[model samples]
Target: MPALTLSRGVADWPEQGYDGWVLLGMVTLSLLPVIRLFLQTLNAGSIEVAGVSLSFAAASESAAEAVRTATLTENLDTPEDMPLERTSLRSILRALRRAHDSEVTVVDLRQGQTWWETRLFILIAGAARRDRTQAIAFVGERNGTPGTFLGWAPPSRLLAAHLRSDPLLSAAHERARAKTAAWQLGQPLPNPHASVTPSVMLPWGTNQSLPPVENQTPDPAFAFELYLQQNLDRPSPESGRLVTIQRLRELYEVFLVTDSIDAQTPDDAWAEVVLTASPRRFFAVTKAGKFKALIPRDALVAALVTRLVRAEDSPS
Candidate 1:
């Protein structure tokens, strides 16, 4: 009902009572070309939007150049019979060990954890192999200084370690040990296998030659102690909070480790290993902090190994 004025020296329109809807439509149609031009400018590289100028093309080129310059390692050559899962685990461990003293971003993806979906930048102060598995002893870094030592093991291994130390299982374990000894000496096993009939074959066969069982179960406390002994020569922080192995295990149990995309490109070999292995859980050797890092879920496992390996291979 009121006369409408258009900006940019356009004449005021009072025709048709200056219908607001028509004016709105006309304004939107006029903006279509400007919107198209803005998008084209963005794709062309440098562009200003909302008073902020950005050089997307240059940023992309810089990232590509960084990837090109990164030091990369050749895929590990392993025996055909060796499981790729084990190989990938080994690769990750090797990378962490090599990347010691370097910083990395760790994101906690575990639901309901203290830092769930939080990212922390941690320095890999040190790493030690534990009990021949893919487990490692990690040193916590804070404010660029190493403070506490922690141990990490696979979930199953950690559970087994705890079960071995459980007071309730002591008596049962001892009795089982005695029975195992008796069986090794050709004694009959209990219950279902107690009365061996001619139809049923003995578990150890007629020769009673049972395969040797190697007890290499990882012990977190022992591993921590070993780590401490290894670092005995290093000076301890004058004042820092000491963390228990149990607490460390509890914290690490819920988290998975991966490399930040900014660190390195995901390794195809490592990706293949992950695809073949299909591991449901992973752990990182990192310090506790509020640092942040990101990696695609699919690239999670591959990135850590590849980045660390690249860091190690990279010339200082």
Candidate 2:
């Protein structure tokens, strides 16, 4: 509860002309929000300030007696919903701390709200910078309206598009993004189902898997790795570029991702490009630039081009 002080001898309310009504009006407005806050807390047994909801649920009496409180039950895994207006990183971090306890926190993102999406992007990224490792689950309605659950799984592109601007994560983001582009472009995407982008798009790269590789000489998909191993002693990523390759009167794109070898000085930013036929397929390119046996199977260089062109010409 709060109080508003009235100035004495003010021209707006001179002492002689003052009535109790004016004071009462000012007091009512001041106390209204406090009353609402108090009522909300009383009803929910939780304290909310600045849109972050913090609620503590005590362990069940029966469970307590058995001393079996190691992890929460699935039925009790309810996500604390955040307020729609200006959910701050501090608030999200607070909710995350609560989530480490018995409650999960869910940020409800409305459909097509670019403003909220951008804000959420910053929040998730900030969480990443802080090394927060919790799966961020968002609840979104279909077409921003009342609807049945189309299914629990949403499109991978839904997150990929939103997360494309991350310069820090572009290396990882590009892996799954390549798959998305391959599928949409009707290119040879051997591992479309093996997507880490949806989770990568969020702040959680909580799992690590060995990058797939081919050992045989001239595995064109790994031309970049071979070149790096041969030329550099200690290699590091520098920059990545996408190149359009046309052969036999057909055009295709390859991501010419680059890396810097060990350098002795600050000017050691010299870089070399690694060629990949698909997003995930990194092939080795020789000084001669020949990729005979290295090209991926079932993805014949020229035939695949036709599918890509057809996919592009198709109506959205």
lDDT of 2 by residue, 162-208 (tens): 35543433443444334333333332223345432211221232332
Q: Per the 3 Å backbone cut-off, how many clashing residue pairs does candidate 2 have?
A: 11
For model 1, the stretches where C-alpha displacement exceeds 4 angstroms are 1-139, 142-159, 166-266, 276-280, 283-316
Residue-level lDDT of model 1, residues 1-316, one tens digit each, is: 1324443136644455547677787776776565445435444444443444433222323333322111102222344333222342233333333433222222121211221000000111122212222222233443444323233333234334433433433333344344334344554433254223212124566432222212322222232222222222133331121223344454454442332122232233223333343353332212243222211222342333334345456665
RMSD of each: 24.6, 30.4
Q: Indicate which candidate wins on TM-score.
A: 2
Q: Clash totals for all models, in order? A: 3, 11
lDDT of 1 at 225: 25
Report, for every candidate in turn, its global Cα lDDT versus the true structure: 0.31, 0.28
